[model samples]
Target: MATLLFVLHVLGAVVWVGGMAFALLVLRPAAHEALEPPQRLALMDGVFRRFFRILWHVVPIVVLTGWAMWLGWYWGFGASIWHVHLMHLTGLVMAAIFGLVALGPGRAMRAALAAGDRPGAATALDRIRKGVSVNLALGLLTVAVAAWGRFGG
Candidate 1:
């Protein structure tokens, strides 16, 4: 049970963090270079739609499985190490950020695209990029904490 939970937790993190990394690092650059605003924006909108849909499922799995391991296997918050607490805090923050991006800019982009408001869509995409940048940095930090925390004590 513990192994299963851990596996699920890690997979969730990988999918979320890795997806962000790919979008910000790889896809954004290539798309910007190859496409005009309308095409680029449309491509991003489609990409985000698919990715965010996957995230809806991944976020819960990550959070729930992490909590399950922390509470059920590691004997809960009080018994866990400092890093465990940090990881939980960071995870929740990431989740909240994800929700904000999805609800706020995600919707804005879609609506703007539908209305043929390219500038509005571009603005929304910029906001989403900034949000993802922050989350990606935090996610990397959390991963560092998790991987190295085991050796700290």
Candidate 2:
């Protein structure tokens, strides 16, 4: 169960984290080269639609597996201070990003798309791009600290 839980946790994280990295790095470059204004806007709409749909599934898995790990730890040793801190901080940041996407940029993007405003969509995309870039950096930092936290203690 522990191994399975660990695998699920890591895999879920990789999908979410890796996807963001790819979007920030590889996909953005390719999209820039291969697409023009209308195409770029439409392509981005499709990209967000698909990626965020997957994120809806991935987020729950991450929460479930993460909680499961914490529960396992709780049963084993009562509580661990470092894990708690890491979990809390990472969870807060993740929730913030999710909120931004769900309530902020997500709404803006959909509104722009629905209104068929390319400039509006572009503006919304700029906001999302910046937000996701921040999120990606934070997520990577979280992963690194989580992996190496024992050393800090």
Candidate 3:
């Protein structure tokens, strides 16, 4: 079960980080070069729509499995303070950031796409861009903590 939880945790990290990489590095540049603003915004809408579907499943499992892993390692609390604190704090912060993404940029992105407002879509995309950027950074930090702090002393 612990191994399984670690696998789930890694998979969730991949989805969130990989999605960001695709969006920021691959899709954004390719769209900008290949299309105009209207088409670019439309493409982002479609891409995020597809991506967010998987996120709905991924993020929750990350949290659930994360909790299980931490609680399962109750014995490890004595192993290292950094190990436990890193897990707990990063999970809490990640959850809060996910909530913001859902409520703020996610809502606006859908609304802008529905209204077919190119400029509005751009604005909404900007918000999502910022939010995703933050998420990406936080996700990286979580990864680092998991690796370096796992057996911290």
Candidate 4:
């Protein structure tokens, strides 16, 4: 059971973090270079819609499996190692950022697009871009801490 939970947890993390990396590094730049504002915004709208939909499922799984490992398979929360605590903290931060993107800018973008307000959509997309960038950095830091902190402590 623990092994299965670990696998699910890792998969969830990979999907969420890897998707953010691809959006920030590859898709965003490519769209900016190749597409006009309207097209770019449309593309981003579609991309984020799909990605966030998947995230709705992935985030809960990641959280549940992580807690299962920390509180069930190994030590309870209070007894967890520093790395575990760091990972949990960063993960929650990422989730909070995601929540803001999904609820605030994300909905605004959709509404702006539907109403044919390109500039408003752009502003919302900018907000999402910044949020995703921060989350990506935190995700990478969490991964590093999870890997190296195990040995450091």
Pitting candidate 2 against candidate 4, the one with the higher lDDT is: 4
Cα lDDT tens digits, model 3, 108-143, are 878987887667768878888887778778777877
Candidate 3: stretches off by over 4 Å: 76-80, 151-153
Against the true structure, whose TM-score is highest?
1
CA lDDT for candidate 2: 0.79
lDDT (C-alpha) at residue 57 in model 4: 95
Off by over 4 Å in 1: none
How many clashes show up per model?
0, 0, 0, 0
Clashing residue pairs for model 3:
none
lDDT tens digits, residue span 1-153, model 4: 999999999999999999999999999999999999999999999999999999999999998899999998658988887899999999999999998999999999999999999999999999999999999999999989988976876
Q: Clashing pairs in model 2?
A: none
**Which runs in model 4 stand beyond 4 Å of their true positions?**
none
lDDT of prediction 1: 0.96
Select the stronger candidate by lDDT from 1 and 2: 1
- Model 3 shows how many backbone clashes? 0
Candidate 4 residue-pair clash tally: 0
Q: Estimate each model's TM-score.
A: 0.98, 0.87, 0.87, 0.97
